[model samples]
Target: MSGEFDRVARLRAIFAGAHRGVILGIGDDAAILAGDVLATGAVLSTDAAIEDVHFRRAWIGQGVTWRDVAYRAAAAALSDLAAMGAEPRAMLTSWAFPRDVGDDVVDEIARGFRDAADVYGAPVIGGNLARAREIGLTTTVIGAAPARAPRRDGAQAGDVLWATGALGEAALGLAALEAGIAREPDAAAFVSRFVRPPSRIDAGRAAAQSAHAMIDVSDGLLQDLGHLCDASGVGARLDALAPTREADALARRLGVDARALLESGGDDYELLITAAPGVDLSRIAHPIGEITREPGIVGATTARTGFDHFG
Candidate 1:
Protein backbone atom coordinates (compact mmCIF):
# COMPACT_ATOMS: atom_id res chain seq x y z
CA MET A 1 0.00 0.00 0.00
CA SER A 2 1.20 3.55 -0.72
CA GLY A 3 -0.06 4.88 2.63
CA GLU A 4 -2.71 4.44 5.30
CA PHE A 5 -5.28 6.62 3.58
CA ASP A 6 -4.63 5.00 0.23
CA ARG A 7 -4.99 1.55 1.76
CA VAL A 8 -8.27 2.44 3.43
CA ALA A 9 -9.58 3.93 0.21
CA ARG A 10 -8.69 0.77 -1.70
CA LEU A 11 -10.48 -1.41 0.83
CA ARG A 12 -13.59 0.78 0.72
CA ALA A 13 -13.59 0.77 -3.07
CA ILE A 14 -13.49 -3.01 -3.15
CA PHE A 15 -16.20 -3.32 -0.51
CA ALA A 16 -18.56 -0.78 -1.99
CA GLY A 17 -21.51 -2.76 -0.76
CA ALA A 18 -23.56 -0.74 1.67
CA HIS A 19 -25.21 -1.68 4.95
CA ARG A 20 -28.62 -0.07 5.27
CA GLY A 21 -28.23 0.28 9.03
CA VAL A 22 -25.06 2.38 8.90
CA ILE A 23 -25.64 6.10 9.26
CA LEU A 24 -21.97 6.87 8.67
CA GLY A 25 -19.32 4.26 8.01
CA ILE A 26 -15.54 3.86 7.71
CA GLY A 27 -14.85 7.52 6.84
CA ASP A 28 -15.43 9.65 9.93
CA ASP A 29 -13.76 10.07 13.33
CA ALA A 30 -16.64 7.95 14.59
CA ALA A 31 -19.57 6.30 12.86
CA ILE A 32 -22.99 7.70 13.72
CA LEU A 33 -25.70 5.42 15.06
CA ALA A 34 -27.17 2.54 12.99
CA GLY A 35 -24.67 -0.30 13.40
CA ASP A 36 -23.05 0.06 16.81
CA VAL A 37 -24.05 -0.10 20.47
CA LEU A 38 -25.93 2.97 21.74
CA ALA A 39 -27.71 2.64 18.39
CA THR A 40 -30.26 5.23 19.31
CA GLY A 41 -28.59 7.74 16.93
CA ALA A 42 -25.46 8.24 19.08
CA VAL A 43 -21.97 8.47 17.60
CA LEU A 44 -19.43 5.74 18.28
CA SER A 45 -15.80 5.08 17.40
CA THR A 46 -13.21 2.40 18.13
CA ASP A 47 -9.45 2.86 18.53
CA ALA A 48 -6.65 0.39 19.20
CA ALA A 49 -3.22 0.41 20.84
CA ILE A 50 -0.90 -2.52 20.22
CA GLU A 51 2.30 -3.36 22.01
CA ASP A 52 5.55 -2.60 20.12
CA VAL A 53 3.49 -0.67 17.57
CA HIS A 54 1.86 2.34 19.22
CA PHE A 55 4.13 1.93 22.27
CA ARG A 56 6.90 -0.33 23.54
CA ARG A 57 7.00 -2.51 26.64
CA ALA A 58 10.59 -1.48 27.34
CA TRP A 59 9.36 1.89 28.57
CA ILE A 60 7.87 0.31 31.67
CA GLY A 61 11.10 0.64 33.65
CA GLN A 62 12.12 3.76 31.81
CA GLY A 63 9.42 6.00 33.31
CA VAL A 64 6.44 4.67 31.33
CA THR A 65 4.27 2.18 33.20
CA TRP A 66 1.60 -0.21 32.05
CA ARG A 67 -1.05 1.89 33.78
CA ASP A 68 -0.01 4.92 31.75
CA VAL A 69 -0.18 2.90 28.57
CA ALA A 70 -3.73 1.77 29.32
CA TYR A 71 -4.76 5.29 30.18
CA ARG A 72 -3.32 6.63 26.94
CA ALA A 73 -5.16 4.04 24.91
CA ALA A 74 -8.45 4.89 26.56
CA ALA A 75 -7.88 8.61 26.17
CA ALA A 76 -7.09 8.19 22.50
CA ALA A 77 -10.37 6.38 21.93
CA LEU A 78 -12.39 8.94 23.86
CA SER A 79 -10.89 11.73 21.77
CA ASP A 80 -12.97 10.48 18.84
CA LEU A 81 -16.13 11.45 20.71
CA ALA A 82 -14.71 14.93 21.16
CA ALA A 83 -14.19 15.21 17.42
CA MET A 84 -17.82 14.46 16.59
CA GLY A 85 -19.27 17.10 18.91
CA ALA A 86 -20.71 14.33 21.02
CA GLU A 87 -21.07 14.02 24.79
CA PRO A 88 -19.34 11.10 26.42
CA ARG A 89 -21.63 8.35 27.64
CA ALA A 90 -19.83 5.02 27.98
CA MET A 91 -16.94 2.94 26.63
CA LEU A 92 -16.24 -0.72 25.99
CA THR A 93 -12.57 -1.66 26.24
CA SER A 94 -11.06 -4.99 25.26
CA TRP A 95 -7.65 -5.91 26.60
CA ALA A 96 -5.32 -8.78 25.80
CA PHE A 97 -2.60 -9.72 28.25
CA PRO A 98 -0.05 -12.49 28.16
CA ARG A 99 -0.24 -15.34 30.69
CA ASP A 100 3.11 -14.42 32.21
CA VAL A 101 2.00 -11.04 33.52
CA GLY A 102 0.67 -11.02 37.07
CA ASP A 103 -3.01 -10.47 37.78
CA ASP A 104 -2.21 -7.34 39.80
CA VAL A 105 -0.81 -5.73 36.66
CA VAL A 106 -4.10 -6.31 34.90
CA ASP A 107 -5.97 -4.71 37.76
CA GLU A 108 -3.66 -1.70 37.55
CA ILE A 109 -4.35 -1.41 33.86
CA ALA A 110 -8.09 -1.43 34.48
CA ARG A 111 -7.68 1.21 37.17
CA GLY A 112 -5.75 3.35 34.71
CA PHE A 113 -8.54 3.17 32.19
CA ARG A 114 -11.03 3.93 34.93
CA ASP A 115 -9.13 7.05 35.97
CA ALA A 116 -9.14 8.48 32.47
CA ALA A 117 -12.72 7.47 31.67
CA ASP A 118 -13.89 9.14 34.85
CA VAL A 119 -12.73 12.48 33.46
CA TYR A 120 -15.50 12.59 30.83
CA GLY A 121 -17.98 10.71 32.99
CA ALA A 122 -17.74 7.86 30.51
CA PRO A 123 -17.75 4.68 32.50
CA VAL A 124 -16.39 1.42 31.22
CA ILE A 125 -19.35 -0.64 30.11
CA GLY A 126 -18.34 -4.08 28.82
CA GLY A 127 -15.55 -5.76 26.85
CA ASN A 128 -13.65 -8.98 26.18
CA LEU A 129 -10.55 -10.45 27.76
CA ALA A 130 -8.31 -12.92 25.98
CA ARG A 131 -4.94 -14.58 25.98
CA ALA A 132 -2.24 -13.10 23.79
CA ARG A 133 1.52 -12.87 23.28
CA GLU A 134 1.60 -9.23 24.20
CA ILE A 135 -0.65 -6.56 25.67
CA GLY A 136 -3.13 -4.83 23.37
CA LEU A 137 -6.07 -2.52 24.02
CA THR A 138 -9.08 -1.59 21.92
CA THR A 139 -11.64 0.86 23.25
CA THR A 140 -14.99 1.80 21.76
CA VAL A 141 -16.43 5.16 22.85
CA ILE A 142 -20.12 5.98 22.57
CA GLY A 143 -21.59 9.45 22.91
CA ALA A 144 -24.84 11.30 22.39
CA ALA A 145 -24.78 13.36 19.20
CA PRO A 146 -26.11 16.87 18.76
CA ALA A 147 -28.98 17.72 16.41
CA ARG A 148 -26.65 18.07 13.41
CA ALA A 149 -23.48 16.10 13.71
CA PRO A 150 -20.37 18.07 12.83
CA ARG A 151 -19.01 16.18 9.84
CA ARG A 152 -15.65 16.47 8.15
CA ASP A 153 -17.47 16.65 4.80
CA GLY A 154 -19.39 19.80 5.69
CA ALA A 155 -16.60 22.38 5.43
CA GLN A 156 -16.88 24.83 2.56
CA ALA A 157 -14.60 27.35 0.90
CA GLY A 158 -14.16 30.62 2.81
CA ASP A 159 -14.70 28.85 6.11
CA VAL A 160 -12.10 29.53 8.79
CA LEU A 161 -10.05 26.72 10.27
CA TRP A 162 -9.40 26.67 14.01
CA ALA A 163 -7.51 24.28 16.25
CA THR A 164 -7.92 23.51 19.95
CA GLY A 165 -4.85 24.37 21.99
CA ALA A 166 -1.36 24.23 20.51
CA LEU A 167 -0.11 21.57 18.14
CA GLY A 168 2.56 18.89 18.71
CA GLU A 169 2.28 18.83 22.50
CA ALA A 170 2.00 15.07 22.67
CA ALA A 171 4.53 14.58 19.91
CA LEU A 172 7.07 16.54 21.88
CA GLY A 173 6.58 14.12 24.75
CA LEU A 174 6.98 11.16 22.43
CA ALA A 175 10.22 12.65 21.17
CA ALA A 176 11.47 12.98 24.73
CA LEU A 177 10.71 9.34 25.43
CA GLU A 178 12.45 8.30 22.23
CA ALA A 179 15.53 10.37 23.04
CA GLY A 180 15.86 8.90 26.51
CA ILE A 181 14.91 12.24 28.01
CA ALA A 182 11.88 10.98 29.85
CA ARG A 183 14.10 10.47 32.88
CA GLU A 184 15.05 14.10 32.94
CA PRO A 185 13.27 16.41 35.38
CA ASP A 186 12.45 18.98 32.69
CA ALA A 187 10.77 16.37 30.52
CA ALA A 188 7.83 15.92 32.91
CA ALA A 189 5.57 18.34 31.07
CA PHE A 190 6.04 16.78 27.67
CA VAL A 191 6.02 13.26 29.06
CA SER A 192 2.80 13.96 30.93
CA ARG A 193 1.12 15.13 27.73
CA PHE A 194 2.26 12.02 25.91
CA VAL A 195 1.04 9.72 28.63
CA ARG A 196 -2.07 11.65 29.64
CA PRO A 197 -3.38 12.90 26.34
CA PRO A 198 -6.39 15.18 26.68
CA SER A 199 -9.76 14.71 25.04
CA ARG A 200 -11.24 18.03 23.91
CA ILE A 201 -14.89 17.23 24.60
CA ASP A 202 -15.88 20.64 25.93
CA ALA A 203 -14.08 22.48 23.17
CA GLY A 204 -15.84 20.43 20.52
CA ARG A 205 -19.23 20.99 22.13
CA ALA A 206 -18.54 24.72 22.07
CA ALA A 207 -17.47 24.62 18.44
CA ALA A 208 -20.65 22.84 17.44
CA GLN A 209 -22.46 26.12 17.84
CA SER A 210 -20.96 27.46 14.63
CA ALA A 211 -18.53 24.88 13.28
CA HIS A 212 -19.39 23.63 9.82
CA ALA A 213 -17.02 20.68 10.23
CA MET A 214 -14.67 19.23 12.82
CA ILE A 215 -11.99 16.59 13.45
CA ASP A 216 -9.54 15.49 16.13
CA VAL A 217 -5.84 15.77 15.28
CA SER A 218 -4.75 12.33 16.42
CA ASP A 219 -3.00 11.78 13.09
CA GLY A 220 -1.12 15.13 13.02
CA LEU A 221 -2.21 18.65 12.17
CA LEU A 222 -1.43 18.77 8.45
CA GLN A 223 -2.41 15.17 7.88
CA ASP A 224 -5.83 15.48 9.55
CA LEU A 225 -6.28 18.86 7.87
CA GLY A 226 -5.81 17.11 4.55
CA HIS A 227 -8.46 14.59 5.57
CA LEU A 228 -10.90 17.39 6.32
CA CYS A 229 -10.11 19.12 3.02
CA ASP A 230 -10.47 15.91 1.04
CA ALA A 231 -13.78 15.15 2.71
CA SER A 232 -15.10 18.62 1.96
CA GLY A 233 -13.71 18.63 -1.56
CA VAL A 234 -11.75 21.79 -0.86
CA GLY A 235 -8.31 23.08 0.28
CA ALA A 236 -6.75 25.33 2.93
CA ARG A 237 -4.22 28.10 3.58
CA LEU A 238 -1.87 28.18 6.56
CA ASP A 239 -0.92 31.84 6.16
CA ALA A 240 -2.01 32.73 9.69
CA LEU A 241 -0.46 29.74 11.34
CA ALA A 242 1.74 30.08 14.43
CA PRO A 243 3.74 27.36 16.08
CA THR A 244 2.89 26.27 19.61
CA ARG A 245 5.29 27.78 22.13
CA GLU A 246 6.20 24.41 23.60
CA ALA A 247 6.82 23.04 20.11
CA ASP A 248 9.21 25.88 19.32
CA ALA A 249 11.22 25.51 22.54
CA LEU A 250 11.35 21.77 22.33
CA ALA A 251 12.41 21.80 18.68
CA ARG A 252 15.22 24.21 19.44
CA ARG A 253 16.49 22.07 22.31
CA LEU A 254 16.39 19.01 20.08
CA GLY A 255 17.82 20.77 17.01
CA VAL A 256 14.73 20.17 14.86
CA ASP A 257 12.19 22.40 13.12
CA ALA A 258 9.17 23.37 15.22
CA ARG A 259 6.99 23.94 12.18
CA ALA A 260 7.82 20.48 10.88
CA LEU A 261 6.75 18.90 14.17
CA LEU A 262 3.58 20.97 14.22
CA GLU A 263 2.80 19.98 10.67
CA SER A 264 3.50 16.27 10.57
CA GLY A 265 3.79 14.87 14.12
CA GLY A 266 0.83 12.84 15.34
CA ASP A 267 -0.97 12.19 18.68
CA ASP A 268 -1.76 15.80 19.54
CA TYR A 269 -5.46 14.87 19.86
CA GLU A 270 -6.72 18.42 19.60
CA LEU A 271 -9.81 19.59 17.76
CA LEU A 272 -9.73 21.03 14.23
CA ILE A 273 -12.71 23.16 13.34
CA THR A 274 -14.14 24.82 10.24
CA ALA A 275 -16.61 27.62 10.82
CA ALA A 276 -18.87 29.66 8.54
CA PRO A 277 -18.42 33.38 8.03
CA GLY A 278 -19.85 35.77 10.63
CA VAL A 279 -20.17 32.97 13.19
CA ASP A 280 -18.32 33.52 16.46
CA LEU A 281 -16.11 30.50 16.88
CA SER A 282 -14.85 29.24 20.23
CA ARG A 283 -11.96 31.14 21.78
CA ILE A 284 -10.74 27.94 23.42
CA ALA A 285 -8.59 27.16 20.37
CA HIS A 286 -6.40 29.17 18.04
CA PRO A 287 -7.38 29.99 14.46
CA ILE A 288 -5.05 28.28 11.99
CA GLY A 289 -6.29 29.06 8.48
CA GLU A 290 -9.16 29.34 6.03
CA ILE A 291 -10.62 26.92 3.50
CA THR A 292 -9.71 27.37 -0.16
CA ARG A 293 -10.89 26.13 -3.56
CA GLU A 294 -7.64 24.32 -4.34
CA PRO A 295 -6.17 21.31 -2.54
CA GLY A 296 -3.01 20.86 -0.39
CA ILE A 297 -1.38 23.07 2.27
CA VAL A 298 -0.07 26.55 1.52
CA GLY A 299 1.96 29.37 3.21
CA ALA A 300 4.63 27.13 4.86
CA THR A 301 6.95 24.17 4.38
CA THR A 302 5.73 21.04 2.66
CA ALA A 303 4.29 18.33 4.91
CA ARG A 304 3.85 14.63 4.29
CA THR A 305 1.27 12.30 5.80
CA GLY A 306 1.33 11.61 9.56
CA PHE A 307 1.83 8.23 11.23
CA ASP A 308 0.22 5.23 9.57
CA HIS A 309 0.44 1.81 11.19
CA PHE A 310 0.77 0.03 7.85
CA GLY A 311 2.41 2.77 5.78
Candidate 2:
Protein backbone atom coordinates (compact mmCIF):
# COMPACT_ATOMS: atom_id res chain seq x y z
CA MET A 1 0.00 0.00 0.00
CA SER A 2 1.80 3.05 -1.25
CA GLY A 3 1.56 6.08 1.03
CA GLU A 4 0.23 3.92 3.87
CA PHE A 5 0.88 5.27 7.34
CA ASP A 6 1.91 2.62 9.89
CA ARG A 7 -0.34 4.08 12.56
CA VAL A 8 -0.88 1.05 14.78
CA ALA A 9 2.82 0.30 15.07
CA ARG A 10 3.69 3.94 15.68
CA LEU A 11 1.02 4.25 18.36
CA ARG A 12 2.33 1.16 20.09
CA ALA A 13 5.80 2.68 20.14
CA ILE A 14 4.40 5.92 21.58
CA PHE A 15 2.83 4.00 24.46
CA ALA A 16 5.88 4.33 26.68
CA GLY A 17 3.83 3.72 29.86
CA ALA A 18 4.18 6.84 32.00
CA HIS A 19 1.92 9.76 32.69
CA ARG A 20 3.58 13.18 32.53
CA GLY A 21 2.15 15.82 34.93
CA VAL A 22 -0.32 14.76 37.56
CA ILE A 23 -0.58 15.38 41.27
CA LEU A 24 -4.05 13.81 40.97
CA GLY A 25 -6.14 12.08 38.32
CA ILE A 26 -9.71 10.75 37.78
CA GLY A 27 -10.96 10.62 41.38
CA ASP A 28 -11.72 14.11 42.65
CA ASP A 29 -13.97 17.11 42.27
CA ALA A 30 -11.34 18.39 39.87
CA ALA A 31 -7.98 17.09 38.80
CA ILE A 32 -4.79 18.41 40.38
CA LEU A 33 -1.74 18.79 38.18
CA ALA A 34 1.79 20.13 38.19
CA GLY A 35 1.46 23.54 36.56
CA ASP A 36 5.18 23.82 36.03
CA VAL A 37 5.12 20.78 33.75
CA LEU A 38 4.08 22.97 30.90
CA ALA A 39 6.71 25.63 31.64
CA THR A 40 6.90 26.58 27.99
CA GLY A 41 3.15 27.09 27.39
CA ALA A 42 -0.16 25.24 27.39
CA VAL A 43 -2.22 23.96 24.50
CA LEU A 44 -5.80 22.94 25.20
CA SER A 45 -8.45 21.44 22.92
CA THR A 46 -11.81 19.64 23.10
CA ASP A 47 -13.99 17.46 20.84
CA ALA A 48 -17.41 15.85 21.03
CA ALA A 49 -18.65 12.53 19.66
CA ILE A 50 -22.35 11.79 19.81
CA GLU A 51 -23.99 8.48 19.00
CA ASP A 52 -26.10 8.28 15.84
CA VAL A 53 -24.26 11.44 14.82
CA HIS A 54 -20.60 10.66 15.22
CA PHE A 55 -21.21 6.89 15.31
CA ARG A 56 -23.84 4.20 15.39
CA ARG A 57 -24.00 1.54 18.11
CA ALA A 58 -24.52 -1.25 15.59
CA TRP A 59 -21.32 -0.33 13.81
CA ILE A 60 -19.27 -0.81 16.96
CA GLY A 61 -19.21 -4.31 18.49
CA GLN A 62 -22.81 -4.82 17.41
CA GLY A 63 -24.16 -2.32 19.98
CA VAL A 64 -22.69 -4.42 22.82
CA THR A 65 -19.87 -1.97 23.69
CA TRP A 66 -18.56 1.52 23.04
CA ARG A 67 -14.82 1.17 23.60
CA ASP A 68 -13.91 2.30 20.10
CA VAL A 69 -16.28 5.24 20.30
CA ALA A 70 -14.62 6.69 23.36
CA TYR A 71 -11.12 6.07 22.05
CA ARG A 72 -11.93 7.83 18.79
CA ALA A 73 -13.35 10.76 20.70
CA ALA A 74 -10.08 11.17 22.56
CA ALA A 75 -8.06 10.88 19.35
CA ALA A 76 -10.13 13.60 17.73
CA ALA A 77 -9.37 15.99 20.56
CA LEU A 78 -5.72 15.05 20.73
CA SER A 79 -5.40 15.69 17.00
CA ASP A 80 -6.07 19.35 17.76
CA LEU A 81 -3.12 19.41 20.13
CA ALA A 82 -1.07 17.77 17.40
CA ALA A 83 -2.00 20.56 15.02
CA MET A 84 -0.59 23.00 17.54
CA GLY A 85 2.58 20.88 17.94
CA ALA A 86 1.83 20.02 21.54
CA GLU A 87 2.79 17.09 23.74
CA PRO A 88 -0.13 15.92 25.84
CA ARG A 89 0.04 16.38 29.59
CA ALA A 90 -3.43 15.40 30.77
CA MET A 91 -6.90 14.63 29.51
CA LEU A 92 -10.50 14.89 30.69
CA THR A 93 -13.69 13.28 29.42
CA SER A 94 -17.37 13.96 30.07
CA TRP A 95 -19.69 11.15 29.14
CA ALA A 96 -23.43 11.24 28.58
CA PHE A 97 -25.07 7.89 29.22
CA PRO A 98 -28.55 6.48 28.93
CA ARG A 99 -30.25 6.19 32.30
CA ASP A 100 -30.73 2.44 31.96
CA VAL A 101 -27.22 1.57 30.82
CA GLY A 102 -25.40 -1.01 32.92
CA ASP A 103 -22.13 -0.72 34.84
CA ASP A 104 -20.32 -3.08 32.43
CA VAL A 105 -21.06 -0.72 29.54
CA VAL A 106 -19.64 2.21 31.46
CA ASP A 107 -16.59 0.16 32.34
CA GLU A 108 -15.92 -0.60 28.70
CA ILE A 109 -16.09 3.10 27.83
CA ALA A 110 -13.68 3.93 30.63
CA ARG A 111 -11.29 1.29 29.42
CA GLY A 112 -11.40 2.87 26.00
CA PHE A 113 -10.50 6.22 27.46
CA ARG A 114 -7.62 4.65 29.36
CA ASP A 115 -6.25 2.96 26.28
CA ALA A 116 -6.36 6.12 24.17
CA ALA A 117 -4.75 8.21 26.90
CA ASP A 118 -2.00 5.62 27.24
CA VAL A 119 -1.02 6.05 23.61
CA TYR A 120 -0.07 9.67 24.24
CA GLY A 121 1.25 9.16 27.80
CA ALA A 122 -1.49 11.47 29.00
CA PRO A 123 -3.48 10.49 32.06
CA VAL A 124 -7.20 10.90 32.36
CA ILE A 125 -7.46 13.71 34.86
CA GLY A 126 -11.19 14.32 35.36
CA GLY A 127 -14.61 14.53 33.73
CA ASN A 128 -18.36 14.70 34.39
CA LEU A 129 -21.07 12.21 33.59
CA ALA A 130 -24.71 12.89 32.80
CA ARG A 131 -27.80 10.91 31.86
CA ALA A 132 -29.06 11.42 28.36
CA ARG A 133 -31.35 9.80 25.80
CA GLU A 134 -28.31 8.92 23.73
CA ILE A 135 -24.67 8.27 24.55
CA GLY A 136 -22.03 10.92 23.79
CA LEU A 137 -18.51 11.80 24.86
CA THR A 138 -16.62 15.06 24.98
CA THR A 139 -12.87 14.92 25.49
CA THR A 140 -10.50 17.70 26.45
CA VAL A 141 -6.72 17.48 26.24
CA ILE A 142 -4.03 19.77 27.65
CA GLY A 143 -0.47 19.62 26.40
CA ALA A 144 2.85 21.45 26.52
CA ALA A 145 3.47 23.67 23.53
CA PRO A 146 6.60 25.08 21.95
CA ALA A 147 7.49 28.73 22.49
CA ARG A 148 5.91 29.47 19.12
CA ALA A 149 3.47 26.68 18.34
CA PRO A 150 2.41 26.35 14.75
CA ARG A 151 -0.56 28.48 13.69
CA ARG A 152 -2.97 28.14 10.80
CA ASP A 153 -2.47 31.75 9.74
CA GLY A 154 1.28 31.65 9.16
CA ALA A 155 1.43 30.22 5.62
CA GLN A 156 3.16 32.18 2.87
CA ALA A 157 2.03 32.35 -0.76
CA GLY A 158 4.91 30.25 -2.13
CA ASP A 159 5.05 27.65 0.63
CA VAL A 160 4.77 24.00 -0.33
CA LEU A 161 1.79 22.08 1.02
CA TRP A 162 2.29 18.63 2.52
CA ALA A 163 0.19 15.89 4.16
CA THR A 164 1.19 13.56 6.98
CA GLY A 165 -0.65 10.41 5.97
CA ALA A 166 -2.82 8.70 3.42
CA LEU A 167 -6.10 10.38 2.59
CA GLY A 168 -9.41 8.53 1.89
CA GLU A 169 -8.46 5.38 3.82
CA ALA A 170 -10.60 6.26 6.80
CA ALA A 171 -13.40 7.39 4.57
CA LEU A 172 -13.17 4.06 2.82
CA GLY A 173 -13.20 2.37 6.20
CA LEU A 174 -16.32 4.34 7.04
CA ALA A 175 -18.06 3.26 3.86
CA ALA A 176 -17.11 -0.37 4.49
CA LEU A 177 -18.42 -0.19 8.02
CA GLU A 178 -21.72 1.30 6.90
CA ALA A 179 -22.12 -1.24 4.12
CA GLY A 180 -20.97 -4.14 6.33
CA ILE A 181 -18.69 -5.28 3.53
CA ALA A 182 -15.34 -6.24 4.94
CA ARG A 183 -14.89 -9.47 3.04
CA GLU A 184 -11.72 -8.36 1.28
CA PRO A 185 -8.41 -7.57 2.96
CA ASP A 186 -8.58 -4.02 1.67
CA ALA A 187 -12.07 -3.67 3.05
CA ALA A 188 -11.02 -4.96 6.45
CA ALA A 189 -8.03 -2.62 6.42
CA PHE A 190 -10.27 0.29 5.62
CA VAL A 191 -12.62 -0.71 8.44
CA SER A 192 -9.69 -0.64 10.84
CA ARG A 193 -8.64 2.76 9.55
CA PHE A 194 -12.08 4.10 10.43
CA VAL A 195 -12.25 2.22 13.73
CA ARG A 196 -8.87 3.31 15.07
CA PRO A 197 -7.65 6.50 13.47
CA PRO A 198 -4.30 7.95 14.62
CA SER A 199 -3.35 11.49 15.56
CA ARG A 200 -0.07 12.58 13.91
CA ILE A 201 1.48 14.10 17.03
CA ASP A 202 5.11 13.33 16.19
CA ALA A 203 4.70 14.39 12.59
CA GLY A 204 3.09 17.62 13.67
CA ARG A 205 5.95 18.33 16.03
CA ALA A 206 8.52 17.74 13.31
CA ALA A 207 6.61 19.83 10.81
CA ALA A 208 6.12 22.61 13.34
CA GLN A 209 9.84 23.20 13.38
CA SER A 210 9.71 24.19 9.73
CA ALA A 211 6.06 24.44 8.71
CA HIS A 212 4.87 28.01 8.30
CA ALA A 213 1.28 26.88 8.98
CA MET A 214 -0.48 23.63 9.92
CA ILE A 215 -3.93 22.11 10.30
CA ASP A 216 -5.31 18.64 10.90
CA VAL A 217 -7.07 16.91 8.06
CA SER A 218 -10.10 15.89 10.09
CA ASP A 219 -12.73 17.53 7.90
CA GLY A 220 -11.22 16.27 4.64
CA LEU A 221 -8.14 17.58 2.84
CA LEU A 222 -9.76 20.13 0.56
CA GLN A 223 -11.99 21.69 3.19
CA ASP A 224 -9.33 21.75 5.89
CA LEU A 225 -6.78 23.18 3.45
CA GLY A 226 -9.33 25.80 2.48
CA HIS A 227 -9.49 26.71 6.16
CA LEU A 228 -5.70 27.00 6.33
CA CYS A 229 -5.66 29.17 3.22
CA ASP A 230 -8.44 31.35 4.58
CA ALA A 231 -6.64 31.86 7.84
CA SER A 232 -3.29 32.50 6.18
CA GLY A 233 -4.77 34.81 3.54
CA VAL A 234 -3.65 32.56 0.67
CA GLY A 235 -4.97 29.89 -1.68
CA ALA A 236 -3.60 26.50 -2.87
CA ARG A 237 -2.88 24.47 -5.96
CA LEU A 238 -3.36 20.72 -5.49
CA ASP A 239 -1.02 19.55 -8.22
CA ALA A 240 -1.32 15.86 -7.42
CA LEU A 241 -3.23 13.43 -5.20
CA ALA A 242 -2.31 9.84 -4.46
CA PRO A 243 -4.96 7.60 -2.99
CA THR A 244 -3.79 4.18 -1.89
CA ARG A 245 -4.74 1.21 -4.08
CA GLU A 246 -6.75 -0.19 -1.18
CA ALA A 247 -8.73 3.00 -0.98
CA ASP A 248 -9.13 3.04 -4.75
CA ALA A 249 -10.43 -0.50 -4.91
CA LEU A 250 -12.75 -0.02 -1.98
CA ALA A 251 -14.16 3.13 -3.50
CA ARG A 252 -14.88 1.30 -6.72
CA ARG A 253 -16.61 -1.48 -4.83
CA LEU A 254 -18.67 1.10 -2.97
CA GLY A 255 -19.56 2.84 -6.24
CA VAL A 256 -17.96 6.15 -5.38
CA ASP A 257 -15.16 8.07 -7.01
CA ALA A 258 -11.84 7.37 -5.31
CA ARG A 259 -10.51 10.78 -6.22
CA ALA A 260 -13.49 12.48 -4.67
CA LEU A 261 -13.04 10.48 -1.49
CA LEU A 262 -9.35 11.39 -1.42
CA GLU A 263 -10.19 15.04 -1.86
CA SER A 264 -13.23 15.44 0.42
CA GLY A 265 -13.75 12.47 2.73
CA GLY A 266 -13.20 13.39 6.38
CA ASP A 267 -12.06 11.75 9.66
CA ASP A 268 -8.50 11.19 8.44
CA TYR A 269 -6.79 13.02 11.38
CA GLU A 270 -3.67 13.60 9.26
CA LEU A 271 -1.87 16.92 9.29
CA LEU A 272 -1.71 19.40 6.40
CA ILE A 273 1.28 21.68 6.42
CA THR A 274 2.85 24.57 4.54
CA ALA A 275 6.64 24.95 4.53
CA ALA A 276 9.43 26.46 2.51
CA PRO A 277 10.76 24.43 -0.44
CA GLY A 278 14.03 23.21 1.11
CA VAL A 279 12.49 22.14 4.42
CA ASP A 280 12.42 18.33 4.67
CA LEU A 281 9.22 16.78 6.06
CA SER A 282 9.72 13.66 3.90
CA ARG A 283 10.13 11.31 6.84
CA ILE A 284 6.73 12.30 8.21
CA ALA A 285 4.76 13.96 5.40
CA HIS A 286 4.76 14.40 1.62
CA PRO A 287 4.19 17.33 -0.67
CA ILE A 288 0.78 17.58 -2.31
CA GLY A 289 0.50 21.13 -3.50
CA GLU A 290 1.64 24.77 -3.24
CA ILE A 291 0.21 27.80 -1.50
CA THR A 292 -1.16 30.35 -3.97
CA ARG A 293 -1.85 34.06 -3.82
CA GLU A 294 -5.34 33.41 -5.22
CA PRO A 295 -8.29 33.01 -2.89
CA GLY A 296 -9.44 29.38 -3.43
CA ILE A 297 -8.19 25.87 -4.14
CA VAL A 298 -7.42 25.12 -7.74
CA GLY A 299 -6.04 22.22 -9.88
CA ALA A 300 -8.09 19.37 -8.42
CA THR A 301 -9.44 17.13 -11.18
CA THR A 302 -12.88 17.14 -9.63
CA ALA A 303 -15.12 19.66 -7.90
CA ARG A 304 -15.39 18.48 -4.32
CA THR A 305 -17.12 19.32 -1.04
CA GLY A 306 -16.09 18.15 2.40
CA PHE A 307 -18.13 16.93 5.36
CA ASP A 308 -20.54 19.54 6.68
CA HIS A 309 -21.98 18.85 10.14
CA PHE A 310 -25.06 20.89 9.31
CA GLY A 311 -25.33 19.72 5.72
Backbone atom clashes (below 3 Å) for every candidate:
0, 1
Shift of residue 261 alpha carbon in model 2, Å: 0.8
Question: Per-residue lDDT for 1-311 in model 2, tens only?
Answer: 11113422332233323455687665446877787988888899989999898888777563223777777888888999899988888888887877666665666677777788888767777777677899889988999997668899999999999988788788888887788775456687777677678868888887878889999988888899989999999999997786777677778889888888789888999999999988888999888999999889998876658878899
Candidate 1, pairs of clashing residues: none
Candidate 1 per-residue lDDT over residues 1-311, each given as its tens digit = 12336634543443233433345544555444444435446788999999888898777867788889888999999898888888887677777777777755666677777777678767665556677998889999888786667999989999988888777767878888887778777666778888888769998888877789999998888889989999999999986455666667776777767677778778888899999867766567767789998987787575566988778
Q: Model 2, 116: alpha-carbon shift in Å?
A: 0.9
lDDT minimum window of 10 residues, candidate 1: 11-20
lDDT of 1: 0.77
